[model samples]
Target chain A: MKFKTDRDAKLGYWLILPTVVAISTLIFYPVFYNLWLSMQEVNMNPIQPNTFVGLAHFIDILTDLDFWISFRTSLIFTITTVIGTTVLGLAVALLLNRDFPGRSVIRGVILLPYVTPVISAVFGWKYLFNPVFGQANYFLVDILHLFPQHINWIESPAFAIYAVIIFNIWRNFPFAFLMILAELQSISASLYEAAEVDGASAWQKFKHITLPELKFVLGALVILRTIWNFYKFSEVYLLSASVNVLPVYIYEKAFASYDFGQAAAISAILFIFVLGFIMFYVKKVLEW
Target chain B: MVGKNTILKNIIFVVLLIILLTFVLLPFVTMLSSSFKPDNEQNTFPPQIMPENPTMEHYKGVLNPDIFPFLIYFKNSLLVAFLSAGIGIVISIFGSYSFARLEYTGRAAIQRGVLLVYMFGGVLLVIPLFQLITKLGLFDTRTSLIVTYVVQTLPVSLYMLGNYFRTVPESIEEAAIIDGCSRLEVIYRIVIPLSAPAIVSVFIYAFMIAWNEYLFASVFINSSQLRTLPLGLNQLFYTQHYVWGRMMAASILTAIPVIILFLSIERFITGGLTFGGVKE
Candidate 1:
């Protein structure tokens, strides 16, 4: 089927105009504006005009120990959560992938944690880990005697990161499970059958047949999840303020301290890290 | 003669499944049960899994205006979700059609550009978007949230719709064209009907994004009157005394719409989500 080339081109531009315009003004423009703001002293007071400071904020951020700490915290949070969610998700996917009764029901129920509202999930966990009255403390301290005292999961900086990681894994593993399960369902059973006929052990069959087939999806999930968990703010912030990942650090800088320039600088640095993943994602995962 | 090995393996699988299920559901069950418990019972020593005497008092408290304006936040969230989905779907339909069917300069590049930009983290955009919103005098307004959500959701919505559009048989549209149907007529008469499921999925996806969104809502909206559910819940959690039952009730209320949405479209979710990772 053919159309008049000139007319088709004209119609195409017209059709895509709204989306292009919206993306330009809302996404691209803000991104460039963010870069410009990163180099300026941006006081929130409308009376104070932003003055270009020529990378001073970036230098300050680079030198700051707090920024480094937050970077470390972000790295730990992202790495742990990505690994935790992926491993847990894969384990569950393998379990559910087998022929079983009520598997579909179990799959649906498993996704509840992931699909539930973040605020709700976070608050629920906060209540569960409430030091004084949380069920977790009740079980650990009173019932099981695992600890002598109620551990303040949300407030104490020592344990808060772990709490946040647990919350993240619980909330996110379903996504990994869903993806891996989809891929798992696609693998040809004949390979496993052939391996079994060759007198292979169960582990050998899985190692030989399953792992290689899952490599691409797993790679994509890890990279994508790494990019996402790096900037994850709401879940961590809502769960605990003590565990200051980079996003929370930047938020505090901008909104709490009113240091827009420094915030932009930190964000600019964060953008570079995110851009690395985005490039990998575009080239490697999407292959676009 | 099936051996004991099969039964042992089955037992292990069941045990692991039960453990995972409990880990996943314990918090939700705790929240729901606590929401029904009376205040005194909620803070008991061995936090009870089930409220012995359930009451609607906390639910009543949630509805009380003097306590918290729960309904207002609910309405605000619904408005934002629906408005974004409505406006976003319309724009994405045309945009996706262009990408999927029409030959145009920069079409491929633009589509790829949208995908890359879509992957840009929201935290990086917060400061500039805030400034942009304030500069445009849209701070503390629903319009600001709606506009930002449209931008946040458009790329993925276009991607999903465009992917689905490609799956629609091109031959149908060509047949229409040969019958002298204009492109606009073909879209209206033929394309849309065939693409209804994807449109619904995209609409639900956009709605879910707007509904669950916290960062943009928190930044752009400051007025108590304009607060969405997540922000409102956060404020309630922090500002007031710890009322576990009422807080749980509010949390449950917040999740109901989303849970219902998911259940109805359970199948489409994985396909849509992994089609592109749920943006933010």
Candidate 2:
């Protein structure tokens, strides 16, 4: 309040006016509009208006097998990828915490997968998992004899979820890595030295110091990643047609099936769940 | 700091580093090598680590107007991303300055409200936005994408730039005010100049979000001629007899510009994006 003049208040409101306007129209309105749409049978005709259906779309979706499949898939993908990325990110962060030549360069390289566009990363993996030409099968089956045969990894319905999970891990772990590494570097070196003064083993020091220090960041990371992975679209959608996570399911329901009402229902369902998660997370992890 | 048995330990350390890096870099290597690989080499089993006979035909194939229409897609992506970044930054810069510098009623609540909206996934917004766009008759135009992308970017841009602005020493600003520089002029002349790295980072973040967007572009931009790069790449892949080489080449071209921009400001981005990470 240093600038307590009325002019300062005026300026602040004026400054945020455009932002408030934009978000209200573009984000806030759409979120509530989606709820309304979920309750309506939207008409395709330009002249004819949408009609109220009063929970019919939700009932229809809840009864459908496909919606259940997507719900299950979203849960599996979110949990597995959240755990996978956190573990991988923690490992890399710990590894890179120690100094070596070209450390910064390696750190930058690790971030490439996360920072690059999803389309490119998916294309790269598509080549890796290509049935005939992919190097993944060639290396695993032919070179190392890890698998009995080349599996149709991305294309097959049975294994495509795993491919999506693996790709999600590959693309997202670096995000966790970047955050954890920042936290890891911030840990006081003096504390580690104090532990070492008592002749503590590496495992004891890590268990006593590192894990405890990482608990909050890891908790927040898991929450954020869960929310994100639950709503993940482009990664799974681009990876394969076989994998139908919730967001992809919504996209198909709306655009592919031309049933915007059902799609809105799915979105409404997802929004409520996410809102509940965020509220709980803010209260618990964020302590807001 | 070298101790006894240092040789074995160093070897193990180097080996571990290599193994970790291999996991990260192999996909990129595969993409780059495959891009250079001719069709015969690309389709060969036990995919080549390095193309023996590198060729530009794949790049040419993707660039061909009839085959991929690279220019139109490229132009669409460039325009959308550029405008999104431009407008988002301009709008956010002012809002963020107020957040960092000024105190006003309801500011904290509004800030939290924005972050809350940030967590709402694009999937939630896509349906209603599509409906609105169609109703407004703005569907299938770059204008629809430009405005949507700008709004999509606002929250993150504000958060990042606001964080950056808060760190500018108050004493410097106070001196400027005492010397009679108006608040807006101080922002224009001093704040903007001092925060170059952060501005670049925010701009790049907004640009890349727009650049890599797929969900909205897929639904909103229905016409083939109006498609952005992600849509174009998706179109290229979903068609019959899609060539691996050409797809990889196009992927490389699409990603290279963003990677270069980001790497140039890697240090600045770490502070902004990872303060509490937000992803596109």
Error of 1 at B92 (Å): 0.8
Stretch of 10 with least lDDT, candidate 2 chain A: A42-51
Q: Candidate 2 lDDT, tens digit per residue, B1-280?
A: 6876788888988899999888898889999999898888888875679899999998988778876777788889999999989999999999999888877898898898788775788888999999898889998999999999999888888988898898888788888988999889889988999998889888988999999999999988888889999998888787863788888999999999999988988887676243474655
TM-score of each: 0.97, 0.96
Clashes of each: 0, 0
Q: Give candidate 1 misplaced runs (Cα > 4 Å).
A: A277-288, B272-277
In terms of lDDT, the poorest run of 10 residues in model 2 chain B is B271-280
Model 1 clash pairs?
none
Q: Model 1 over residues B18-68: C-alpha lDDT tens digits?
A: 899899999999889999999879878777787999999999999888877
lDDT, residue B113, model 2: 79
Q: For model 2, what is the alpha-carbon lDDT of residue B243?
A: 83
- Tell me the tens digit of each residue's lDDT in model 2 across A31-149: 88999989999876524698999999999999999899989999899989999999999998888888788988988899999889999999999989888878888887899998787
